[model samples]
Target: DDMTDPVADSARSLLDGHVVLSRKLAELGHYPAVDPLASVSRLMNSVVSKEHLLASQRFKAIYATYQGAEDMINIGALAPGANRRIDRAVSLIDRVNEFLLQPIGQRCEFQQTVKWLLDITKSWDFLLPAEQDLPPEVPAGPNEADA
Candidate 1:
């Protein structure tokens, strides 16, 4: 009973923090409005939720794989397939910061912190190799097909 108690408590805490943070982020503005803090806050909640689910082993193997992918993104671990997702997430956050936070109008200090967090995430050493230079697969010749 004691063993499960801590897990349950931790899960509860993460969930509570996620919910509170989500609500606070939502109160700032509407979606697609390019609010960096709001976007980063939402992403952070998603990362925490996925991590909690992975830790609890509550999902199917496929779901766990997806969670692992998200974890790589959240933690900025480099791997072959995970880079695109991580890059996309970082790019979105970056755009939000550039468009919304960098301007003089309607500034928020929280937005600056979010940008810093994003920079740290993007700078992680686990980044995957660039995909642009991958060697193209040659078509199998007619004789090669028989082998």
Candidate 2:
């Protein structure tokens, strides 16, 4: 529980703290007509909200796919598939890191960069443990008892 996954944790931190936050800030500047002060205030409030904090925790847990974690999927059981997915995730993160290293205001390809970040996060959901992978319960079924 107290253990740390340096690789995954670092990647998650960079993605959340650097990539995501930076993108949000950049978006606020895209349109000059919007009140900068209000936009920034709203953004700051959302960042500190309970919902955002909980989501950040969930994201960190998902990204921390290290082996031997009790709540995590058994990496050994799905080594080949897991490794492939992790590699892709790391590659996308690396690309983001590289893009961030560029001089400020010089970065382009916003759509592609955003797409990569979205893809990376979306893919992590698949690597969750089997129990967590189950679809949400529904009331509709063959019979009320089955529901």
Candidate 3:
């Protein structure tokens, strides 16, 4: 595996981003009197929405990389329709932006949706095979063993 792979790097960066944005949004909940619309709009512009676009591209890259070959296909075998999880996470983020644009009193679970953004990060971890899932070592052939 290439240690400096850009796709993996981007995924890590996006995961870190979700952590920051979720913390900011969660902090707003502490100040009950503060209006969330402005803070959310700023977050959307600054990080959340930008990440949302990158995520779509990342999803395609990931699927193309993993959707074929037995070894590369472990992601699908492990998560089964895992690509949809990314789409769902993106949709949740979109709902947050849509909610922010609406007038007050329009019901939406802003906090819950923000929290769920972490799921996008969590879902990627599932793609990694656990130690138990690793294939067993093959026995060496007689000629190779003599060497």
Candidate 4:
């Protein structure tokens, strides 16, 4: 989530970095640039609930799988043996791509983010647009913006 912050954050700020999303989302091309590898969150065990934490882990795993599949595809090695996995990976990547279809200034709530993430993990086939896929919008909730 940090776009290379220079400020010497306090211990609270350091640990509060429960969610470090990859600003390199290809889905954000409605603007420019993205970095997919640097994304994962779950540091605030003291504040966030357990269920959501677990969901976050699942979300991380999915992103990891997508990255792996992308690597394979780039190398032209995603062939017969890893066929299904490759399909799932590309599908997951596309799903995340679909997620970037949001309007400007609007933010997804923590519950809504978790909901989309859970839905993302449960089924690779189900693709939702940013508007319909997301839960109801809320005030500035527990979330960080990406590129």
Candidate 5:
């Protein structure tokens, strides 16, 4: 299965940044002493707004590559291993979605969830393999093995 290394690298970098930012916030006690929930809300708002945009962009780029490969196959190109890459990308997107759905609050649970996400982000470099090979063109049709 051929994976797109650039897309993976981008995701890794974004997640790493998120982890670093979260740690910095925690160390600085940026969550207001007067109202921790307010601070968390503000942080979540930034996550939902700015960070999500980058996540969406990365997913879109990956999805576009998958779609392009399909288009190539429809045009009789010999591309292979696109489905595997698409599957991996979909899994990554699912993880992001799951993380986004977690409730926001000042509770230890919330903080732990954030820390868990940071850990996951930090470990993305290890999750993906280092190398993948892409064929020059799409195969004749959808490979049943991919299904």
Candidate 6:
């Protein structure tokens, strides 16, 4: 909402804020875990282009769907698509859990974010790959890449 405030620490204050990631990422030890629900941008409609806005909206919809599935898990219910959608959501979440949340003071590059977004936003036409396709922990970052 206040993207112009250079002093603000929250994402809404950033130039192109969209969805806040999740604090759960931090509890799980992901650095800079942003709350997707908290990361909404108030300026998208007015300041951004139609294509970008639509792309962002699509991304958010997937996150929301995944979030809904998470809620269903709590109530012991599954969404209509069953393991198919869940697998995709898992891959999406795993990528977030593995690659998206950068370390303290580090930032995700544009292409990285784009690739991640595209990979997850894909419509499921086939059964999602086995959970084995998802990483159990954070994927190696730039820091880990050298070591």
Q: TM-score of every model?
A: 0.23, 0.27, 0.25, 0.53, 0.28, 0.50
- Clashes in model 2: which pairs? none
lDDT of 2 at 137: 65
**Per-residue lDDT over 113-147 for candidate 4, one digit per residue giving the tens place of the 0 to 100 score:** 76786677665432335354344566664565431
If ranked by TM-score, best first, what sequence of candidates would result? Answer: 4, 6, 5, 2, 3, 1
| lDDT score at residue 26, model 1, on the 0-100 scale | 45
Report the lDDT tens digits of candidate 2 across residue range 19-88.
2233443564532222221122324335465644443333343334331232233334433344544444
Error of 1 at 37 (Å): 22
lDDT of each structure?
0.41, 0.41, 0.41, 0.55, 0.43, 0.60
**Tens-digit per-residue lDDT, 83-107, candidate 6:** 5556566556655445446766777
Q: At residue 92, give the lDDT of candidate 6.
A: 67
Candidate 5 ranges beyond 4 A from true positions? 1-80, 83-85, 103-111, 126-147
* Prediction RMSDs, each to the true structure: 13.9, 14.4, 15.3, 17.5, 16.0, 16.1
lDDT tens string, model 3, 1-147?
Answer: 332589856765555232212344345552223223212222444655555544433443333333233253434443433444333333344343343343446555755654444344334333444543344568999899989
Q: What tens-digit string does per-residue lDDT give for candidate 5 at 4-37? A: 4787557655552322133433455543212211
Better of 2 and 3 by TM-score: 2
Q: Give the local distance difference test score of model 3.
A: 0.41
Residue-level lDDT for 43 in candidate 4: 52
Looking at model 1, residue 7 earns an lDDT score of: 75
lDDT pick, better of 5 and 6:
6
Model 1, 60-116: lDDT tens digits are: 222223344656666657555434444444444443334333333655675555454
